[model samples]
Target: MSSEKQMKVEAVTAPVDLGEGPHWSVKEEALYYVDIFNQNVHRYHPISGNHSRMHIEGGPVTLVVPHAKVSKTFIVTVGRDLAVVTWPDPSKDCVITSYKVLSSVDAQCPDNRFNDGKCDRKGRLWAGTMGATDVPDNPNPHLGSLFIMHNDAKVTKVVDKVSISNGLAWNVKNDTFYFVDTCEYKVESFDCEFLRGVLSNRKTVYDYKTSGLHPSFPDGMTVDTNGDLWVACFGEGKVHCIEPSSGKVKKDVDLPTNSITSVCWGGPQLDHLYVTTTKKGLSKEQLLAQPLAGAVFRVTGTGSRGYPATECNVSLPK
Candidate 1:
């Protein structure tokens, strides 16, 4: 559709338990995503309509960032460890059989697990950890933390006292960074050092308020070429495109499912908008009403464009 308000949403994949982390791979011309609870990594070829999946055994792969230099290699955040996932012979078989742990998160905080993450412009992997679900009734808001994995595989703790770290993106100018801690119900900004993977001067730029959309907790986020943020509202089934300066809504894309998890721009020209959803906490009736809850959806011909996704420039050690 030509109108932004009346954009068409199409289902790209079947259902997943908790679908998150939608990343576009320019090299493969495909969309890469994960089902966190299902512990599966999926790749979809837009042209052939071929969808392939591989399940990780021990833990869930929270996010996948394509390596900037190495083909078929990704800087992955697996469970609570910073790891590298690579397809040694993808031309022969598509299954993922190798993943190496670059560094282990501190064992003192057993409740922490890696969640949503991405890389900065300079190729450093920036992933955040969240409290484990075993203690949902007593979620330690301060236990979660954000970290940076350098090119040499050194990990650094950058932000502390975080809970449910979700969306992360830099402005179009690459001078400012925006991050979301879902428990806070707000999007915060900081001065960014693209080369060093450093952040400072935390300030709230866009805060969420429940309107007709209850529990509009900010989840996954992405930046268009315009520097505006398209943030998925977890319980609202809506994605808000907000301006960074005044924190005002530019446009909203509504979907049929309530638990909208993440969004990214893909396709050849990076003009298509891809979204991920979840069915984790739905009741029986809710599931019945929204049968396509856990599927990945996309909005095509939106008249908007996205920046070329930054690849994970940091390479894992051999």
Candidate 2:
């Protein structure tokens, strides 16, 4: 068993429908997340009491992170398309690059879209995918994939046949890359070789048990300064701190909303932990009880900045 971690909730809120990806914008000293159904970008601050939202004309902007160096600019995905939006510029308008969409080949149904995503240590963008709707008739089971978009306008299908491709992370030592099979309720680790864009020796790193405690399927995940994985339990209103090497849950933080979706570490000193939740599949009682459903929340005592996504690096001829 790994050393135990303490967990607590500093704030309770909700977002739109699916709050999957959580990223830290260092320059803004705040966290950015998406409401997949609402097609909006949310910003939250833990220290200065600033929170707001901007509507983007897209179906689901899953992940929004710095598009380049700290210039208040970010790159995001609107359904099957990618676009660039500058921050501090806070304008609803965005600039999208003309990059080819991920192939809509066999096994990849059309209704599906991008899910949990992050940039690697080398400034490459990585994100997972899943069927657009998770119902009985989707027929797209295991149709999702893991993808990497090189700065050179090339994208690689790292892994296919994923059901819910959520929660992507890499250890601080830069040796192992972590992935979450959200629907499978498992987290796996692969050898870290960003330059070569390779994965090997895939092993189960974490699993959410549903017996003793009703931990929802783990979704978007990030690693903290101490190398612990902070996982957002989708069905359960909670986040987990676990040791990846041993697959042991060290601590659990309960969220006010029952369906907490994702988490991240942000702030000037990297001590604030931000979380996002959903209000999509809820009953009247559940919605009323968790009125802040689909809102974003923050908490202290979680300590350490998890990691920031890298922008797809574009190199110009020298």
Candidate 3:
């Protein structure tokens, strides 16, 4: 395990209220993340050191993933709707020319909103929704579900009765799918049928409560070339690298704040780990104590590289 002093952690973007769902765009050579509460989508280019954000009206924007075939077009989760958005300019904060709502989820539960999401190697978008967290860490339980958005605009619910549906990753071979439901305090794995978009044989890979990592809610996650899981521990302020096969912690990278929200692999070589955090639930005293609570951090020198994030393959209607 590496200590905080041994890791190179630096802030890459200005603070955001509730930062989550980070995606590295290999085509653009930049990083895109969302500010959930503020309803904003942000972009940062590490090469030119340019930072910009576009306000997304209608509802809270939880994620932004690039389209596999379209330039400047992305699939975003706005409130409960899966919308296709287009940003013509990358250098400036410009209005989105196209915001097409494809389909919505949990229409019965208006309080439930989209959380973390990512595309599989097959380019299918897998996202989840959670009940409102009006009281901070204590979210309304069992009002969430995980869904897979097909290329044909079909949304299928894969898992239900979830609380705070978050972090997702697939194995190197694409046969195993990893998921996190924060209230469950465990990391789960399933046999994945990528072609059919089916998941079965669910098993627990890591249990935070049993491991004694109390208060460390598992949030966004990513996988490296070595097939290890890097999980952001929201309350613990650390990212724990776990060997899924054995469910053991291989390394730990601590952050400066407790509200660590999500993480991704970026940089030209994909060797850098990009992390997002939040300041939504902190008190004034706690905020003062942790000054970098809501900043996006870059951690390098981990000796691991991640595969490029898969883009959503669905074609937008003309």
Candidate 4:
């Protein structure tokens, strides 16, 4: 297998138990990510080289997006509920009381919990779900699903029977939406009607399982300005830039750890690729080999750029 190599990558911080869900704050000039197993939300300032985390008491925070209207507020998926939370001040201890629950998921699938999510250009929160870890051995992965939380406080089920819903991205034109169900080992695309937040014409854009080029599955993803999709390869320690139309791998950037989980583009010009990895399931020997397993990394000089993240404007009932 051939790989396109041009970007330079490096670790920027120490590792977290499960460093996932990376989000770039253009306004704050900071990067935010979550430590899923630790139930913590972290903030990192690249220039200052400072890092801090706030504890989420009851359940883990799967993903977080900036509020569309409020500068210091955010919309996040906490456990099986949707919430509006304030960005914690790094100078003070993060208080759990700052979060307000806006919506709770279906009680029918109590084993299900929210996983990866972000706001569409229309400011709607599109998030996916997965089975809770507490379930019995090898729980029903098919129980997972994807959902849309609208700006008007309405919730709709978009896709069902999904297992381990992970990465989500949209083309620069906003006409196509890409999704990843990690267990399926493929990145799927759908025709997206942005105004109404409707998706149709589902098709596979790329299949890692069939490609046999890598030993990992696709996790988190982001789209570039040139319309290529950059996806993190869990257990493979690399991120790939793929051409969506042809479903071909155009480029790949290797990392120091094997469990890379997610990626986002930030920096003033949106040229920096920030990545997150995990240290969750490594054996003693494996951990020793990848001491930076759960740390966050950044890749620069990639000759590509990404679109800005749309803020979450969905209104939550007080």
lDDT of 1 by residue, 211-280 (tens): 3343568899999888888899887788888888987777888889998999999999998999999998
Candidate 2, residue 76: the lDDT equals 72
Q: Candidate 4's residue-wise lDDT over 156-258, tens digit each?
A: 8888887788899988778899999888888899998878878899999999878984457899999999899999988778898989878998888889988
How many clashes show up per model?
Answer: 0, 6, 0, 0
- Candidate 4: worst-modelled 10 consecutive residues by lDDT: 132-141
* Candidate 4 clashing pairs, residues 3+ apart or interchain: none
Ranking, lDDT, top scorer first: 3, 4, 1, 2
Could you tell me which 10 consecutive residues in candidate 2 have the lowest summed lDDT? Answer: 97-106
Worst 10 residues of 3 by lDDT: 133-142
Give the clash total for candidate 3: 0
Candidate 3 lDDT over 1-318, as tens digits, reads: 555455799988888999999999998899999998788899999999999988878888999998998888889999899999888786689765448998899988999999999999878899999998833255478888999999888899999988888889999888999999888888899999889989999999999999998767799999999999999998889999999988999998988999998999999999999999999989999999999999999999888889999999985788
Over 4 Å off in model 1, which ranges? 1-3, 88-98, 134-138, 210-214
Q: Any residue pairs clashing in model 3, and if so which?
A: none
**How many Å off is the CA of 230 in candidate 2?**
0.8
- In order, what lDDT does every prediction score? 0.81, 0.70, 0.90, 0.83
Better of 3 and 4 by TM-score: 3
